[model samples]
Target: MAKRGAAQQLQTEVKTDEELEKFLARPGLLILEVYSEWCGPCLGVLGTLRRIKLEIGGENLHLAICRADTITALKRFYKRSEPTWLFATGGKAVSIFYGSDAPKLVAVIIRELEKTLQNASRPTYQIGDLQPIEAEVLRIKTEAIKKAERIEHEKQEKKRIDYLNRCTDVIMENLPDIGVTVFGPQVSRDMFKKLSEPAEHLKMQCKDRKYLEVFAKDFEIINYSCKNPLSDDVIDQLDGKELLVCFWKIDEASGPITHVLSTYAHELTKERVAPPDDEINVPHPIAPIISPIKVKFEVEIEDGEVWVEEISSEEEARKLAERKAAEKSKSATHLQDESRPKDQEGAEDDDEEEASEEEEAMQAVQPAFPNMALDIDLGLDDNIVSEEEMVEEEEEPPKPLTRIKRVKIPPIWVANNRRTHAALIYVFFRSQTSGFLPPDPPPEPPHVVMAFEAFKRDDVMEVVEASKEDVPQYGFFTNDTPGEAKLITNSIYKYDKLEEPSSSDRIVLKVNKVQSYTMLSLVQFEPTYCSNNVTSGRMDALKFFPEDYKTDEEIPPDAQKKQKKKKKTQDASGVDESPKLSTETAKSIDIAAGDENTEDSPKALEGEAQTPEVQAGETLITESPTVADPSAVPTEGAPAAGDGTDTQEPPKEEINADLIEAPAVDGAAAATPAAPTDPAPME
Candidate 1:
């Protein structure tokens, strides 16, 4: 079967059943396709079969189709139903596929051949009742169809060429001034005929404008020199006039065409009409550049100080240098005096010893530093102090600090972290005339906030004024936890006034993040304090910790005593409870807690513990819990009156909810009796 496939290529042999059988007799495949002459589908399939024949022209496979009307001829194989195909191995039909789909037939033949050819030897069949005349007629019909296809392809090729010529003609019409300066590699005269023909306008310019002509490097044009690529005299003639130029080709891998083009454009622009040794000052107009020039234009590299004004005269340049020298001299003198050695021994001492002495002096009395620095205890072992000495120290051994490395923290990092936490810090304009205020922080972990996105707070003014602002904002914060959300101002000068004499309700305006802030409010002062009257009405102005805080465990025993005395006097005086001045108290709490604990811990009684707010006419009535140690007998401050009578109300009534509430803090509920475990007992 393989030999037949190879032999068929060398001769125009018609396939007979006997030949197919002989081909299949070997260890190969037989594909018998059965069809009728009257079937239109069979004709279509024959075309595909010829295509397949071309594709697999060298394969060990036989394809044959029998007319169903001639049943006796196909009896040994398979009968045709419409068009049918049989895959045979070793003279026995392995599989039969019936279809008009040429692709399906081809697939089945290939699949069957793949399955059977590996295991069975090819089989031989007899070519019965087939005449040479009928085979010749089929071959003639196939050749006629191929001839028709060739005619159709040639027609398409002619149309495509006509369309391309039309496009090229249009391109050539607009390119009259284009100068074809061919360099390197000559095309034959026949190929040169294909070059863009010079139009009438270009032909006229040949006499005066010197239109380009191509010539071999060894041969010059009718009058031009080849050795000198660009003649100064030629360039002078082209000045102040537009000229189209082209390099026939360029090899960037070598040569200096780039450098040459740069020098050409520069010298042409300056109208440098003289050789280096000669003097000529010919002024020329800057001419319009015509297409197409082949030169890479890139920004020139310049020295850092290139932008400094160039002194026009030598005298002026020297004066500027002298001024700079004087400035440097003053700086050098100051630096030298400050850094100079006081003594030989002082200079000999290591920086460590000097640093230690400076540190001791700093401890004794701190010097004013411009920048805030964190004091870190770096316990570098000198080996002089034994491990025993570390153990002898009462406190836990300090963690080793290698060096005080200052790290720059970007504001964006903080803003992004806050955004992820669903909290934002941005300026919000209260009214058109007023400045913006810092937004209330988010009530979640700072690290959870997403990136900052800007938005206008006033855009949702109706929502804001309706007392639904916080809920929606919180929802936005929670929902947009992974993205930065910003609110910017809607208009200029429509925000809250920062230094205004009159106190008014802040207007709805944009509360945008810093990065998105384009309109800046020039606040007279930063960190403007909120008045008591405004805070009571606008609760949104108040900032609170994200998580609930547990009250402090205990005030120092002495501090507690001080609070009681103050409270007694307030109650005796019968004064109305004013807003708490808890700045000092908050500071003290922060100090005792080592900055980690952010609880709303009341200050130890100076007998008059203040609330956190500095607002006027606001009151905080601290109540003693039942669980509080009686021996501690802690006093809760009372509201004082003019008559010096204690008029303070008892703590708010406790409800059942208090008993079932989750612990306020993570670690401590039972341990701290000073922190009220329950709400104040009912009056």
Candidate 2:
């Protein structure tokens, strides 16, 4: 038994005749695959097999895979890259199929199963013999097939060259500028002539992949450049200009040219070849990104989190990588120095060794899962073997409506993810005109959610049906600092007129065009009260928590008591306070549990804050100015609405002062609970 790599279908690994017999004996109609050890089974077929099992129901079928070279019956397919399917029932292979033809395989299996189902008594069974062919004969057939495929490929190549040759001379106005805007420096007329200069191997991706697979091992088209690889005349033309062009051979566009990709910007520099071992490496920085839970992204909470904006170019990423690597080197040196102070005599040698170690650590070599180039995409589209590959997904049951909860976002979520804010907004709306309560906050924020991936990284301002909607926009924003990765939005569309604040700022929609938002240098204001009348049918408006807002467990015992007592007393009075308003204000502002000395806490404004909305029918509720301790001050000259009733008020705990002057969050009010006195609750 030759040693096979682990990726080979080893679950039903057939080593001996006994194992093979048992596998075939599996109760239902079984499809056993034969694969070589060196050349693994086609992985793309795994999805198809899974669909077959799921669609037809697994109880009716059994699927397995085993090494081909080990089984004498499969010796003909031992080294073949194409697949072989062995259909078995009643402890033996009944029929066989060669090639990874998904449609043919599916049709055959389905027809067999249908025949079995229709003729239960008088069954139609076709016994196809599994014979092993002579190695020489197999080689001859393979050679003939290869020669035919080569001629066909050459013909296609000629066609492609003819097309390019026509375009090279004649200035055809339309030269198929497809994917230029998205994946380009754009391939222009003059540039297309220069594009024909990417050495012959580079033009053909297969040839390029074959070369890279042997040398690079990573199966990626790494762009490298020399100061002047082109002739002087060519160099003179493109010297200072960015090469706004890329080329895709027009020949390979059936369906599988699917992964046709983009290029990395490689600056042509002076040719400087060094010894392979001493290539003078630059190591990438290996700093752990801060992404903590609950309160805020630990990156923001921790001192280690580095704020990295857009790494716009390869130059920028490389520079950042170098700086990160250096930081690690220094940190490692510091640790080593502490551990072995007595070895200070060889400190210089130790430093050299450490530098070498860093270089080795950053070496672009991954030895594990060797020969994975066979599976790597490498910008080649695979041939679609099956026609009409429709995936019918069973309709899942409608999930119960969930109330939106606070999402504790990590700092790393902002990196490479442009839709960080926009996506979180959709969590609230059931549809454009409808609103639904998001699910309650779990102990830990869910780090993943389902999404339909329609846009790529470069598709920033794509216009969609939803984008044209006149409905108000929604998204996340940070209150702690401006321009931080927003956690969620406080977007509320109130159909009520608002009172003009003396010093409130306004963003006049001078135009309805979309503009990128800038943050932190903001004058945001939040209302102290959240009205329950915003939703239609007077449904309580959905509310969620912010960064400063503490969970039930985080809330201090005394503060919780104050909240409960306050709610009880409010019920006693005729004040119609919304449950959300009462509880939301208390949970949001009761950060008395936090370290008072912590400097990061946001400072609220002095004096009482006001809600701009002054609807006649809408009852007004405010987080009235709270005293340090309610018992310290005595109430006087207050109207007794509770008929001579002496009621106990909420114990006034001094709320975090940082929350006083709430930032102007559009929909949500700055809900800091007022210190309740032993009197009728203020309305």
Candidate 3:
């Protein structure tokens, strides 16, 4: 039973010699104990081996026991006594233990195991340990990688160049004259090719011959080129594909070329065509042939119905109607001719006769005022007074004044009446309900207004006379109705010269009958106030009178005296003498008084009327103020409190030609008179 049990235990734990070699070939430490069951030391070492196996566990070291008595291969391979031990690692023999000294043997095994482990852990080779073949292989791989990258870059560059070339060709073909040069980085050929389809489509779409003709005539393309080409990704978009091209138009006169950017294929789509419908065919029989006859027939179609033509056979009716119309037209023309006035020559003769009668009438009725004539014809058609009324007025001439009427008259009225006898009249009407006059007259006078009562009433004359006194600025008159008074007033007023009148101003109204028209004459008066008698005489003398009243012998005494004096002066000088400023002397004075206020400096006097002296070798004579006017007042008044009239004239200073610079007259410089020095005080 013990032998069987030991045999079973040995069979499980102990490995054969071949197995021991296989176990040593593995990666970790392998420990083996060669033993015999009959040996007491071997039996005793079993327990120690078990303890060593536990110390060196399965992970780091493998433990196997070989019974030399039971295993022939291990028995021959070990060739050691019972209880001997062997240690191997990584297929190498580490050490062999011969005696049964458990502690010493275990120590030796552990030391050898550690030595194998240390050797196995160290790298087999140091840095720079590559073989020749490996170095060559690494270099080849590096060169291959760089070459692949370069090829890829070249492929991309080729594609870009191709795209640019194709785009340039297309632009040049379309715009042969546009002198455009394509430039910039290359782009994708696919995008450039895609642009052409739409560009051609646009060219086809512009079908108007006139537009094409105008484009060709107005602008000649000198060059066309790509600017910045589109990218491949952008061109690949489903819609809105655009390519920009720069085109330059050449000027016919060799002027500057116009450069413009044009886009193509930006938005385009294929034209859609509608599908055709199915067709149908049907056969029809032909009519049989027939012989024709030479008979004539006429057919007429009217209002969607056919009929034959027929003549009225009454030709005289239209001619008779036309003849009657002609006769009626002739009668109408004869009536129009009879309705017209007399011929131009006879009418002109009649007008001349009437003008001669009017002239005779005007001459007969001329007024008594000198150079003052009134030609009042009043036209036979005066609506205000009929011919019968005029005849009655002529028969009853204004009765001679029975008594003198005293009226306050303005001085201005007398003054104006003495000159032109013309005046402005203003008429005012009262409101029917209120019986009140319109508010204060307009700023300007000679205005007409409606009256409460008609002018024909006797009360109207009293009202007008009262108004004349109440509103003294405006003249009031009444004759017939207010409407007739307005017409006469407007004709006489003509214009209003005065706006507001002073307290002393007055207006007078005179009513008279001229032929058939009722005439109203107005006389406005504004007083003239003068401070002195001289002003009054001058004002009166300057009054304007008609030319017929003026005569050559009527010249004023003062004017005749002025003309004689002027003639005497001209005779003495042989020419009219007038004082003029000497520009050269004034310029010299301005230059001499440096930095001084011009007003403070003594003024240069004007040259006297005497002829200027001419210097030798000079054409222009520089005139100087040689003689001061005795009547002229001195600008620098008498010193302190003395009157300016008492001041004596400053003595003239002789000019030095060398001190001043004046323009050369003929060949020599013109002499400028020196400015006067400060004047000496009078005694």
Candidate 4:
């Protein structure tokens, strides 16, 4: 069912350097397909190449295959992956066609070949070595390029934040607070498994207090639950009242790697009240908890003489009675007020005006406000929207009022001396595939992620114990696999670098081992060819002009010869106009007779000063080239054969408004090119 050697002819494979070199050395043009077979999309590439070969399998075109396994080979010639083709001719690559479109591929190759043939018929200058002058020019160009790149990078960063801000309503939105716990999907779970392989024993050794202490000092784990579950309901039920409000968080792994990754991914949520509002008299979302839960707001239960704690105090009950009475009065008043037509109309008008003003404010600020989430709570209660209900959602079961004050404490990592001057961590595993467990019981900090606030390993154990009230228990997890460690480490390192300075800022530094060789490849040394044997050189006259010498405006052939004669006569007059043009440019212009006449013009200038010494303070413009006398040119070429030439012409050089305004050039080279071989001069 298959053609013989069809598979051999259509070898969909990666080629070694040997194969690539042999193909490149062949006659005509050889298009080598560079690709990896493991890539799923590469099959389309094979089909495209096959179609191209079928269409252009002629004498002028040839086809080959290449693979990018060898780093050296890839660096030298090919780019990574499938769907890339290098068009080679005469041992040098001429063009590249990318993608898996058959028609497009054929058309590109055909166009290139046609252009190559046409170019072969034209005259071309031999490329000379890139001397000092060219290198200097390149240096300036490179600096300009680098400056542009920096500017662009800054712009992109600003734009990225700007876009994000537009979508979110939070102010200081881009400024992520230092040390905030983050939550996000895992990016490199496999890498973590590999790196944690050798440390698998530590998972068991965690039983030892010393070992546990070490890990606990480095990290802490807590089970974080958004909803109070049966296991965690006890935290709120410990005293006398039913469970009010509780939350839980747990870390999936131990060590700096886990902490950095979780933080970078925003995997940890902030310890917060049910809802955050400025009007809330309770703790702010980012504020710290000063003490454990207080169970009583009405009366206190006493242990012997000392009051152990109050479940509810008499004073609090009285206050609640007063609040209920006020509510009852307010309700009665509202009922009576609703029956009044004037009151009803006034309330309606106020509501409409408030709604209109809010809409206007939102529209005005919409562009600058990113991440704006509109919350439409239809069942929101109206108790005049007091500080408690307005700022923080009411705690379920009607929590007894408790005082919450903010306090500042050093980060646990720093207090426990787990973090030194600086450290770098990378994550290889994410808690996606493998769910994380609650921290185990311990005396010190529990070894976990997102618990940087715990000072000792035992503290982690305390948090773990606290979590056992409701947290799902963690068991032994095995994630070791090839390349897992590297991936995890890199992920953590990236996380640390991306963290805010205030939270985990001490760890950032210059990053290396980045694999952007496309830019680096260009900076590498390569031999250059140019015409100049001198260490430094400048552009030649012909380079500025093409051979098709047609100008938009041209002088007549007779007029051209007359111009030449006038130049010769100027030389014979012993005036050194030759100084105006550079020596190299003069040679390219083929002004040999002018220089020779200069040598023969001593008799003509016998009485003239060589310098034409302008009398004290008189400008040279007052002399010959400017404000010319009526006798400057022979009237209408009265002498038909001026200076032995049939055609006598007026001066070709004329000043224009712009040229006259240009600053006079100092008698020196305008610019110089740098030489690679020469050391740059010290300023």
lDDT of 3 by residue, 480-520 (tens): 11111221121112212235422222122222212322112
Residues 490-524 of candidate 1: C-alpha lDDT, one tens digit per residue: 22222322243112111222122233212122111
Residue range 237-315, candidate 4, lDDT tens digits: 3223211111112233444433443332222223535464577866555532212332322332334434333324776
**How badly does each model clash, as a count of residue pairs?**
59, 31, 10, 78
Question: Can you give the lDDT of residue 471 in candidate 2?
Answer: 15
RMSD to truth, every model: 42.4, 35.4, 66.1, 34.7
- Report lDDT (Cα) of residue 156, candidate 2: 55
Candidate with better lDDT, 2 vs 3: 2
Cα error, residue 490 of model 3, in Å, equals 99
| Tens digit of per-residue lDDT, candidate 2, span 1-683 | 24355323323557555677677666767777878764567676778876777678356677777777687655656545557777766655556677777888888889766654454443223223433433355577668656755665677567655543443222212322111111111223343333333323233231111000111211111111112122332223333433232223322442212122221111111133444354446533332212223221112223454444433378688999999999999999999878885667588788999999988886746565576665566754676444434332334554544332222322211101112111212221113212233332333211111111111101211221123232122222221111122333222111011243111111110111224221111112222112222221011111122224322213445557677567545544534354333433544443533332133222333343442322112222332244565344323322234334332222222222222333434554444323233345554
TM-score of each: 0.15, 0.19, 0.15, 0.21
What lDDT would each prediction earn against the true structure?
A: 0.36, 0.38, 0.37, 0.36
Off by over 4 Å in 2: 1-11, 118-128, 131-683
TM-score: model 3 vs. ground truth = 0.15
